[model samples]
Target: MKRYYQQEEDIGLFQRMQQDDPLAFEEIYNRYFLKLSNTAFKRLQDREMTEEIVQELFVNLWLKRHRLPELKQPESYLQTLLRNSVIDWFRARARQDGFAAEMLAQPDRQIVNATEQHILYADLQQAYESTIGQLPDKCRQVYALHQQGRSVADIADQLQIAPKTVESHLLKAHQTLRHVLKDYSAVAVALFNFVF
Candidate 1:
């Protein structure tokens, strides 16, 4: 009975996709890609390979849309399928004897460069902090609360200011940061690192 209901839902979604419903594709992609990518990454341990596998999975999924009814839990099924594919790829490379050896012969440049990038990131971060420190007191406070993950409503309530005022302060803070960091590519990276 549960299988029947799931099949019906799958059919509905598949039909919507076939009709070129953008939201359906977006929903399906978002709902599965992260989990599937994580599963692939865990197995492959190569970021580029994992990304390629996940992208290929999405492309294959769309191409095989008519077969959606065969899936039990589409997301889980895709993850398992990707994991098996990664394992098979490793096995095939192992059978080729020198393939793994050649891959291992290359230095892990990305890991090595990441250390220097981290130091540069820290420097840019300090610069951003110093610039933010120069904001007007209320703007600094509002931006600080925002950086702490406080919502505008929560910040307004805590600071005893109107929400519009909190938003205005945040906007002013962002404008200031943009102006201060306009000359550096590191500025965007710094802001993203700080925000996230």
Candidate 2:
């Protein structure tokens, strides 16, 4: 069995590497590390990642030495490994950048949404309060009772008014409020449906 190797035209070094010869592995690493780094740097154009890929390859070569026997074309095999590693690094970086972009934009959308909701609610409350105060006393009473989930018949019975009168009061209240809140009609109508 091949137990040691020198770098001169020797398939013996690969066989020795399969037998876990540290000397043969050292020679191979020293011979190829610079070439691998250069190849990777040229493709990736990033210093830190190029160094990392080369180091990982050497570390993997040591750990998976038993598999080295299958590598008849050592130079081609090393290039293939480096090429695949660069592709993987690029894909990972793209996904990370997309996620970071979303995260960066998220706060802006949330702030705008919250501010709009606050302003809309404020406008709706002001219109509702001011218009209700302008309502005739009977109409304001009917509208308040209707918003509190009371049936028209129940409100009429409690207020000693006819059911038809109660409905008329509610209709007048809706029309007057809609007119008073013309500028905020769309938003107020949305909220009004939930209330009355």
Candidate 3:
């Protein structure tokens, strides 16, 4: 009976969100943010990345409120969205060479032990390197510097470009890489410690 009442309340909040009620959205976010953050953190094991995944989920939820379909269970809907967001992050990480390093640094490394997994990793690694080589000179330069742990301001100063410009280049590089590697994510996410 209490669960049913909570579902009714959640459905009402979803409807209000579609009508642009910031308060309703805040209520939903407040209710779910910690749960979603903890869910993502358990899989990601990285605080910053988990926060990014959860924040982006809420941002997209608010941005696409009007288009969201009616939900019998908003919690389920949010969970599905969070799952996809985590997978998307995995895809982005797979495109970066540092992904290997990050995985290796994990105390309990989930390295590719199976031949099939190794093949997939090798293919993705090659694709990532190729994609990096194909980026526009400026975008590639900004991305390489950023990967080396340079701050946006530092990269901007070194490249004689605005910080915003540096960010723009990095965003472009990431978008391109994500697009190119999207197909491999479902498989890659499963083979790695990204299991939910």
Best by lDDT: 3
RMSD (CA, Å), candidate 3 to true, equals: 15.5
Q: Candidate 2's residue-wise lDDT over 81-162, tens digit each?
A: 7766776676577558784466467988767766986888787887789889989998999998877656688899999999
Name the TM-score of candidate 2.
0.46
Better of 1 and 3 by lDDT: 3
Task: Evaluate all candidate structures by whole-model CA lDDT and list the values in order.
Answer: 0.68, 0.74, 0.79
User: lDDT for model 1, on a 0 to 1 scale?
Assistant: 0.68
Q: Which is better, 1 or 2, measured by lDDT?
A: 2
Give each model a TM-score: 0.41, 0.46, 0.50
Output the number of the TM-score-best candidate: 3
Better of 1 and 2 by TM-score: 2
**Worst 10 contiguous positions by lDDT, candidate 1:** 187-196
- Lowest summed lDDT across 10 adjacent residues in model 3 is found at 187-196
Model 1, span 5-28: residue lDDT tens: 334454455567666665566667
Stretches off by above 4 angstroms in model 2 are 1-4, 99-196
